[model samples]
Target: MRIAQVCAVVSTLLFTVVAFADVKPNQLFSDHAVLQGGMSVPVWGTADPGEKVVVSFAKQRKVTTADADGKWRVKLGKLTVGGPFVMTITGKNTVTINDVLVGEDWIGSGQSNMAFTVSAKVAAFAGMQDEDKEIAAANYPQLRIFMATTKKTYEPQSEISGEWKIATPENAPAFSAVAYLFGRDLNQALREPVGMVVVAFGASTAESWVSRPVAAGDPQIKTMLDHFDDLYSFYKTHPNATTDQAPSAPQTINARPGKPGPLRDPVQDQHQPTVLYNGMVHPIIPFAMRGVIWYQGESIVGGKAGVAIYPHVMEALVKDWRQEWGEGNFPFYCVQLPPLKNSSNNPMVREGQAHLLSLPDTGMAVTLDVGDPTNVHPKNKEPVGDRLSRIALANVYGKKIEFSGPVLAGMQIEGANIVLHFSHAAGLIGKGGPLQWFQVAGADGRYVSAMAIIRGEAVVVHSDEVVSPVSVRYAWDNYPDGANLINGAGLPAAPFRTDSQDALSAIAKDFTGK
Candidate 1:
């Protein structure tokens, strides 16, 4: 009996060693966990070819075999999102992931400004004293945050590492301030446990988020492809690159003398393609998201250059994301670029941003009235997040409240004056305070300050100096600090340019076909 027991122990030890050596947990529960409501959930894993694998989640079992190249996956059927669950994936060995929750998942993306941190924007927090009380008293044990750890690779990454963290004062502040603020409001407003997957890099153009094959295929996007090649190549070469060594956070473009070189080396900026998408976004495409909130475009805006191609880029990104996730036309909301400091009265970037609204079921949250003239990183994120919530409430969740400020619809030429019609003017009043940042230009194409009066559903604009007004503009400064033209609901109208004497168009035509 003693000899038999010793032989059995030796056999067990050998089996354990062989299993450990042969098994690898190369994939993860994707960054964005799909919410399962009354349906079978698909939980997947990857391993060596022909390797038998088992996934256990929520009292269900799924079995699959790895392909010839050592890859495997499985789907568990019909599980709900009410979980403090653990998923154990076993093949030759066993790997267990704990504290997994099923809930609504969202994608927070865009440029550097979107990637801005809460601690970096100190003032944005000061206004949220009431929110602070709520954050301090937070007890939602089910809420989880999956930060898409930043990476750059030429090929899609098989795995990424980040764990679920409960929202505490210590952990919550480091979260994307915009994403967290938005998530907090949604979690409270909807009363459903929310999970956010932040997959943004600062200073990234819309093109960076798009796949190379998709961008290269579009005629309008080909120009941008040439520009992003080098940036992409750099990302592919340096997968673990970061901006912490620079003066700012993940997204700031630091071209200062002391700054590390561009995210990619300067010499390769035009040589490589799909670097950022491969390294940063490719690995994220498989994760499912309910919707996306984007905050970018500050990096890619050159007035004329922005206008001709930005809309196409927006379309490409939307289409690409939908294709990757296999979800059709999910809600996509974005923050319009705020006011800035240029003497010109015809701002094209804002127009480019507004143009994205032409796409179906998309919303733009304007910040014309909320930005500082010199500070590009605006401190007021609460209103930005709140405005976004209104969209989710109205368009996504189907609530009917006044969610927008005034939006420019069109204008009519009435003799010497231009009558501007606006949407979202249901409860507009202009008597108590000043209505500012209106400009009118004549046939000579020179814009001068004009007196604007809130005339019923339209703003009638005219300048005495220019009798035959060919063009009119509102809140058109690069950074219109005093852009006070907001509705009673406090949402700002995005900056705009009419077809009337568009200077930037002429400039773009000059550069096109060159």
Candidate 2:
């Protein structure tokens, strides 16, 4: 009997050794994957420690050895704009990935809107406009999409769950609507394959997607970490506390009796700083991609403090992502929050989003004219995706096109009037009616409704109430009802304010229903 037991133990040990010896690529390298074109592509995976792994793809072969941790990576030379190639990774065991494509690759991330799918089959996602028609026509074999499962964790993880899928009528319905449209547009315009990896969670904050080390270093964001720490401490001391008794406690308590550490409620508490990054984003670090598109900021918590620090949060996220990816200022485009009724702080949030334009290679897609006042998740995502693609087409792909609407470039104060100069202001006009939603203020800082006119690529504003206007604002309410300003390109102008004053109180009465 003892000899039989010893033999069984030996068999188990051998099986474990053999299992660990097999070379495995990251989930991202599976069949039907799309590699970013025009850049050195990175292919990575794991094997037995010290094992040499050779990767061959698209007429290029690269070799590397797994370190003490059994992790290895190889970078292929810059690829051209076409592929239906195959990749082979050889170590102790050879793995072949077929039907691979090389082309433009982008990462789409943010909160619910970015996660919104092309169809409303899922309970969580609100379907886009003409969902059935769009789904039926979504047959592009050149477009691939990968959606990372939503998750949160206190510590960074090394693996995640997802796979690349070729866009088709069957699969495209589940794809992110904005991302799908963006990829589809690129595939037709650039006439090449396109891939989009979407990683997003509903109601997630920007700070939640930031790395722990990055958030810890920021003074404003560190407070959020501190708050989580306190919540953890409370839960640790009250092991027997019920959910009702401890209202803020994590839903599940997976604590061991004698091993004490920070208790994580990843399921219930997604807003915790760095949680989303640790679980969903960290595992995919350094994945080769052309750029990122983001849509968030509807659920900013912390009241005034949260609203004030949003621009800084976005700055940190953009810089950290670029630094981690080792990609120098790759285009980071974002969607500005659209008009919503009764959302008092939306203008402030939109202002904060615009501040991201100060960073290099960054752009904002204005949605001022494409919002649903009743529904935060508007179904008119075609314009949103088209606008984002316009930015990329113009800025990244060298397409000569008008990618944006009028932006406040300069403001000059003349007696009894404030003249606002704008860039991208060719053929500026108000659709369907006269100019509206323009407001002006005198030295007293009291804003009142003003009349505005388009005058040679500039909007001139004057109010009988303010003879000498000191400030001018356009479409500055939560929902500016008649703000019809647009450029000749038919793109709506982004909301703007010339002064940095707290105008919430001054304009509160004007937007009472909004």
For residue 20, give model 2's deviation from the true position in Å: 2.6
The digit string of per-residue lDDT tens for model 1 on 1-514 reads 6999999999999977675446555333632233433444545445666888888888888888888766665656656767667777887778777667666667788755666655543435223335465456555555556666666555555666565556676666566767777777777776666777777665566766677779779876665555445444545677557533322211222122224444534222212235456666665555555678888777654345454566667778888877776767777888877765642113666666665665666777877766766666766777788888787777666677667777666678898899888877765655347667888888788989988888876888888899998887776767766767667676666665564444323212200001
Residue ranges of candidate 2 with Cα displaced over 4 Å: 1-16, 233-239, 242-268, 501-514
The per-model lDDT (C-alpha) reads 0.64, 0.83
Q: Which ten residues in a row have the lowest lDDT in candidate 1?
A: 505-514
Collision count of model 1: 20
Model 1 regions lying over 4 Å from their true place: 1-42, 75-81, 121-139, 223-273, 301-303, 342-346, 500-514
For candidate 1, the per-residue lDDT at 404 reads: 75
RMSD (CA, Å), each prediction: 7.9, 6.1
Worst 10 residues of 2 by lDDT: 505-514
User: In model 1, how large is the Cα lDDT of residue 499?
Assistant: 49
Q: List the residue pairs that clash in candidate 2.
A: 342-514
